[model samples]
Target chain A: MNGFKIIVLAKQVPDTRNVGKDAMKEDGTVNRAALPAIFNPEDLNALEQALRIKEAHPGSTLTILTMGPGRAADIIREALFRGADDGFLLTDRAFAGSDTLATSYALAKAIEKIGRPDLIVCGRQAIDGDTAQVGPQVAEKLGFPQITYAEEVNIEGDVVRVKRRLERGIEIVKASLPLLITVNGSAPECRPRNARMVMRYKKATTLTERQSANEDYLRMYTSHPYLNIEEIGFKDLDANIDDCGLAGSPTKVKKIENVVFQAKESMVMPATDHHLDALMKELIINHTLG
Target chain B: MNNIFVYCEVEGGVIADVSLELCTKGRKLADQLHCQLEAVVIGANLSGVEKQLYPYGVDVVNIADDPRLEPYTTLPHTSVMIQLIREEQPQIALMGATTIGRDLGPRVSSALHSGLTADCTSLEIGDHEDKKNEKVYKDLLYQIRPAFGGNIIATIVNPDCRPQMATVREGVMKKEILSKHYVGTVKNLEVSRYVNDSDFVVSVIERHMEKSKVNLKGSSIVITGGYGVGSREGFDQLFELASVIGAEVGASRAAVDAGFADHDRQIGQTGVTVRPKLYIAFGVSGQVQHVAGMQESSMIISVNNDPKAPINAIADYVIQGDVNDVVPKMIKYYKKNTK
Candidate 1:
């Protein structure tokens, strides 16, 4: 496992779980501007898992990769600030509206371009969409075995052991090597940004960020005396243009809507002996208890 | 319009209960659209599965039994599903939102380049007939799920995609009983192009379980305290009340963040959604996210020091007093009632 290269799939998502009146658009799509763009919580958990592996194997290096509109570079910089060895932002106008399938295609291409990796770690699902398809789908596209809902990981000799979270309980599973692990929030919390790493890469930027942040922050990002930003763009990585974005994506959003639950409540009885008996009888009548 | 595909999941050669439940759900959904319900099972010794579909009202059962289907590898499972959907061209696909179903549904949907709705609370079909006399029975699937912290419902439709997919949460719907008089045709499809070792870059060695003592999902009653409950010691008292009531203990997200409870026991959009019959919320503010999960409970009683606490608005009964004071009295009342 020496010199192992780990690639993490990170995303920039609106803080949907904690949104205000300004957080949504008229169409129900998140207003990314009003809501603070935070690193996807699950992706942070994935980064934590990757960092754990790096800690166990000193020679291992972790790189963060993201494909989104250019503003997504903030997620990459956040990752680098947390001790990732490198960051790659796969940005272009073409990648817009890429669903999980198309997103996985572009990411798999990026992973291939980054060279073969020992492992790929991603959050089980992004909070905004909550589809949870991308991680397993990416592993599928990459032709690697994947462990979903990974709560724990242990490596001994050549064998990599993990605890896969099931609905009932956790299942301790082992995948030999070069596998993908999609972590849940239950995975160990990520370590805080290392001051040394923050001092080293806080100013790192993508070419788009450097060119676009055209604001005062852009100057601060580029000229930060203690940091380094190696700008990598679409051309630095080998990818087919058609396969990288919306054109390569076969699935299109027919519609999106806000989901609400209108629930009606009625009571049976409390869990007293008589009420418990009545509840059991009701369940039996409905053929649910027996 | 054609076949309705059902992913019949199996473990150790035995079909899972949820797959059978989906078959029952699919049978009705397909019937409404005037199509045949086709069950797609991938594994060996599927002979019993086909015979068992009759009671569930399945019209046809498709089996792709092979050695590679063993051990539940995502590669082989999704490949088999993709192959079946491409060939059969199901108008709609359904899978249980179990851990396996949640993992597999999206993979197959993505591979087929179709839309998938996850954790659906309800599903129905609506008609969209043209005004002209030439009317075709087109499939209109409406997938309803909770969103906006469960305060709102989102209905997702894939008007253009074939075999529209939805994964349903567990135990939300009832599975129809097998009718004694029903029978269906079961055909075994040959799979020479099954997934092999070469197709897999990594292989699963073994699966272990995590270490958590409480499972809030299965609890009948949850005694959840909130910020008004004060310190962790107050939470401990709530846990004691929970033990006396034979209920699981839960907390609003605030309590969990305050280090009063474990993450699994936290209820809301970011935590588990529960439908317990009796929900006792002590000192909770009833934020939208907190209410989103438990608003559907059979009974809700809120004990808040603040009468104006948001939780009291939706509660069935609001007990306005300090939770530290009121909870003990409620416990005493419950004990007296039980005795």
Candidate 2:
């Protein structure tokens, strides 16, 4: 039972749950190729809870990391076609427009240059910044200990247990290891893609995607360096080009509006359910949940 | 020396209605920053929530309590909110985007380097700019929200942080309560040496409560669903029409990622924004992250067999139909018109 070095953190957003009419662009921005980036559905439910705590410990080791741009190495080769043994992209141009405190300070300095690990798991928000606030600001910038919406994590020996998902119910905590979790889209639904690990890590890539492939996919990712999915920019960590991204973000967006509430006159019913249960007891006896 | 704190959130001994709607929106940002609105209250027998947080216009209430600050453990509520924002330097703090303020507002805004703003639906005090020295920062807090998916309304502003934090969302603002008692002063925050006992490394091992406090974020009636309520026994007949109409079911992050409900019964821009008074969207085909979390529900009623469902133009009652044959005929016509 040895195995507990996970990492997860994935992102590559867009696919704003499929919005259209070219999902906004008259000055507000996000027309990110009319949506379709994927792999941020609660970071694939936090990479299936770090592949179920690396299949209940046993030489454990999941990985992933991401940051975005450099086409977020397509969510680090979709977390190595769902099993992840390697992944890290962090991308560059000084982390571009960060926010979420410079994306948790370039992911807590790329999890301290991808070193500290005993679990990190992510995804409590990132449907293009719904702001669950970067895994509790990357567990308060790596001083660790974060459990968040989690939904079943287990481990039990050096502590972990989790189960979170709360908005009024369900909670169970434990925490201890080099912790940090987030998960929840009601966690547990990330398993497909092991057609033999997709014909063995379907060309892993990300050396800027093997320098734009071709030439027999650059001699099979330079003779399979675990098919090379590692692209660390911001000078490979220790980052601090002003704390890494929109000059180390501190919130800021002043005005945007575009809201559309409107509907003040709506009385169209008739599919009958006794007039929708008598207008739900006449709006709960007129306290009008407003 | 301006103020306005409000992290109240007591939970089941009373206090969280989004911390009395962020103290009635921190008593109008503490009467537009003339100062004094406080309210802290960490846990452990959060003693008489200062008379239920002084008619919600507080004026100062603090109260850390103890027994290891009962229940909420985020290293003792982020070291008692980073030592109450560094010994009350609060210019504006606020929380209640629940789940213990999204896990204690970004660890007390990253241990007070400050700048939070998550889920906020509006806060305002105004004056922002400093987009790299375009300088402005006058009485800031703006914070606003709903971006890109609820399609715009951004606002945000931390203009060089200093407790100008935020969180909001829980029926976005308005829980009013100042009919009297703004005569504050309650204090009591010792917090045993800023927490120890290995910061109570996560404790509460069982609190299954979903038993009739039936609050889907203060539900007055909410039947949510979507992904065409197509399975998981169509959300157990939309929770048998939310228990024959006492109501509260909510979902849609495509029926909670197609497992058909339970990311704490999700309900929108990353779940839970509800304003229910009667929301009822079955087979819910309304997205704008589930209609920006129940578009201030005061009567929505959708149903959806897709008559071009965009929650039928902000539904006030648009039943086109088929939530597994209209939610068992609206739960057999509400148990035969309620006895």
Candidate 3:
């Protein structure tokens, strides 16, 4: 059977899961600069699914498509180290302040430019903005069907079967080729970086990154063409200027308030036998516990 | 022409609770805006489904009953919603943030270029003054949600979009019946006009939807653990304590992510929201997301090793200790005192 082309959408997000004391500033806003940037957790799961499909189908090529600042190339290199064939970094100043809709527009345009692959895979949502809209929005823009919360995906011939994780239960669905699937966090964890592949892709950098690199990397790019990660900006795609970033996004953040919970009067006690017994007695008397 | 619309989800002929909740909220919004409340239900064997929604102050019920529409597929549902919404031109559209709604809301929003927010914690009708544009939009649906890992609450608005679309989780809004005898008209849609045969590209093969055993939302007392609980085995003690007290067991998002608890038992902004009478948090350093779900509990007890765990701020009683030491002791003391 002939191999199919697959694309995996990914993002680089702040490590919000491990927010420390310093993660928030005095003004009650997130201190984003202090947080370490990492590949979005579920996006790694998506890359793993794409890699499996590529491995299962001979001659299949998997591409990673991500839209963010130039730093996002880090996740692409990370994907390469895990078995992806190549990657595209969609970075431009115009893409800033783009909500899910505008982001999907930019991504759909890039996918069209890359020649609509047979399959597209992405994480259900990004951690920075847990709005799981971009996947289905992109599918709508590309005029393809979508299966979300996918836990497992199996492909045979022209048909693909997907296992979806729902709130109450599970549903197995089948669709033909040329569709999109959003991987759930419940899916298998991505395999760790292979030492051999990491060494091969350690020098892979976008053109912007290559320009800032030292003289040795410039010489290495000439000898190894595959190490050059393709970069796409606003000018590269056929898109209307109004439909790019903030102009394209319909939803606007009217206001942002720092989350503050009202402090309640509390009796503080140490974990001792006496304090424990008294606390239990008080709860039972108050009809709070039995 | 400009009214409020709710996309009611039907499974085995019964309307979803979230849809009814939206209808309740939508009715209020419609009244505030002086518009009528309309509900759209698409499924097979949907006779008399409008009876469930009319009580929620729904003025119009749009039904597209088709055999193929029983189990929702993304394309057909999206097609029907987009066509119906375009014809109706509703000012606001709301849906449940369930698996079906999340999968369908974005597609419809993208098709119509309308703004859509997911898992909104609160929805209010408020006015927005665009200072930069010197424009004022009156009575807009303020979609309030916690973002950036629940560090901040953001209020979003769609000033230019036709239908300000938003999806709220099932338990986020309260469902109330306006009147048992409230009357509304039902408009049976011609399914062929709204959808095409090509829309049925994806088909459901197998399905197993079991009723959730843990009723966190319905329980009066809840015992929750966090990452500090350590491992899957550590959760066993929490279960023992829950069994002793007849409380439901819940977990923080961190605990669920750490594989110490099931995702269904997670109580946070992303998980289930519960307002039990008594909430006992063990080893939980409450992030805003976790607090968002249970801050309304009548009484809260926080047990954490850290004296200044964030959860302690809203807790009625703060016990400084380890979950391993505190849980077993609490269980023992409760048994002794109650007996």
Best by TM-score: 3
Off by over 4 Å in 2: A1-38, A41-75, A79-86, A89-110, A114-131, A139-201, A205-290, B1-20, B24-37, B40-54, B57-94, B98-104, B107-168, B172-178, B186-282, B285-339
Looking at model 2, give its docking quality level. Answer: acceptable
Model 1, A133-239: lDDT tens digits are 88887877776778899888877777888887776576766566788899988888888888987777766766555565658865675466334334344566566
lDDT minimum window of 10 residues, candidate 1 chain B:
B128-137
The prediction achieving the highest lDDT against the true structure is 3
Chain A only: TM-score of every candidate?
Answer: 0.80, 0.33, 0.96
Model 2 per-residue lDDT tens digits across residues B84-118: 67877888888877778888888888777678887
Best by the DockQ measure: 3
TM-scores of all candidate predictions against the true structure: 0.80, 0.33, 0.98
Clashing pairs in model 2, backbone N/Cα/C closer than 3 A: A3-A60, B231-B234
DockQ of 2: 0.23
Docking class of 3: high
Better of 2 and 3 by lDDT: 3
Better TM-score candidate (1, 3): 3
Candidate 2, A82-152: lDDT as tens digits: 78889888888888877887878888898899898977988888776777888888887888888888878
All candidates: DockQ: 0.26, 0.23, 0.85
Give the lowest summed-lDDT range of ten residues in model 2 chain B. B330-339
lDDT of 3: 0.93
